[model samples]
Target: MSANSKVVDINKNREELITFTEEEVETIKRTVASDANTDELKMFLHVAKSYGLDPFNKEIFFWKVKGKPTIMTSRDGYLKIADRHPQYDGLVSDVVRKNDSFKRKSDGIEHEYGTERGDIVGAYALVYRKDRSYPVYVFAPFEEYRADTKVWYKYPSAMILKVAESMALKRSFSVSGLVSREEMDVQQLEEDKESPTKRFKKQKEKEDYIDVKDNAQDDSLSQREKEIKRIVGKSPKLKNDLLNYLEHAKKENDIGEEEKMSINKLDDQQFTQLKSILQTFKRLA
Candidate 1:
């Protein structure tokens, strides 16, 4: 992705490093204010620009996770580099529904896993370079996360193919030291981004807090979600009010296209706040 702003040109060759978003600019300034590593931040910015990546994308740079500043290319980063590379040829990548071709681990036997669609088992990719004699091949298998088919629910085929393609590209161009940090699982990266602070914790409290301390000991997230839905379903007026409340609570930029449950996604503190608003609407109804 192209940068949103221009960066300070630090080259004798007169090349601008890259531009940063307002948030990144803040991070850089904040790092300096807090006596943190600003030099390392600049170094990462340069590396990101060299790769033609936008640090503001959170793939290339984010201050929330680690202390040191360095470039971390996202999945987008890998795709972008592949798109711009002069030596690049077409990529051959696809989802593998079964182990039809490859040998199996259990019995050391190769049999048809069959035509019935099941969980996507693996991904295969080959990066062909015009200059290289041999194409780089990569076969990446999917791993289960917390017993949930996490990333599979989002971009199972596409993401898996990307992983394989990136793996092949990075390995093939080992001499160039090319890297895409997205080779790190995108699902894991998302979960890591939310750490130490839940992304939905930003809901504004428009009403007094409701006391849900009694059910606070319940460990089941499903239980809380069900209870909240039940309460909201009691009246149409309540439901409308709940939706409107959430809509009003978020600023224009704060809302994602499908971020309707910003309130529902909130933590206990905000949940209680939302419950109070629901109760008010119920009383009025």
Candidate 2:
């Protein structure tokens, strides 16, 4: 059978699988894989199709690093692939804490934690296979994989657990080459332009796209600065209020490094939402 036939045969049961038509291929190139060349696009499509991943649904997508395309998926995507494996029996995972009870033995793993689990130290995942006597256990430490992003800042324990689960799934299913976005750094995620939250927000539109702008500190105003200035046009009092309020929030630890880094490039809606949130914090102060 031809490569196309093989791809079709692999995912024949999945009625929602993407059909790579001439126009559809053009759309994929223009949207998600814009930076890719003909060969890169072909390779991306082949891998995505082979794994029954639909890029439109955000199961798998391309990441451009230094003008080169790299395939990346989410933790859920890893689970999807693992579930498809004939021997994949089940998965078990949890976050470990500094004060929590955790142990690893030759045959099994043990962990216990309470609601007040001090701080997330690490996470563990166990992938059960039908053919294996013991499940595959992988422990991922927080310090090793944590990124200084808003998501990690807000959900450290959950994020670390995802990293562990992704690692375990990859190893258990023999999945290779592609990396999960949860394992990537802030710079890599930023380079992707479209974040998971932004994708969801724009999912309804036919030509949906996130307006990603540079957050670099230049002498001139950045896009975010410009937007803020426009919002505060001719309102010197409001400008001072914002600056003073932000300074106070920083001093109170209401805002951290992650928020500061992201504040540089937030779209208008996000900026407005931040202002509303800061107003709430101001009341508590």
| Candidate 1 lDDT, 146-202, residue by residue in tens | 112223345667667767777776665551323443343344444545534452342
Model 2 CA deviation exceeding 4 Å by range: 1-19, 186-285
- Best-performing candidate as measured by TM-score: 2
TM-scores, each model vs. reference:
0.48, 0.61
- Write one digit per residue (lDDT tens) for candidate 2, span 212-273: 12233445666656655544444322333344434433433445443442345444544654
Candidate 1 global lDDT: 0.50
CA lDDT of each prediction against the hidden true structure: 0.50, 0.63
Which candidate's lDDT is highest?
2
Model 2 per-residue lDDT at 4:
44
Quote the lDDT for 212 in model 1: 22
Clashing pairs in 2: none
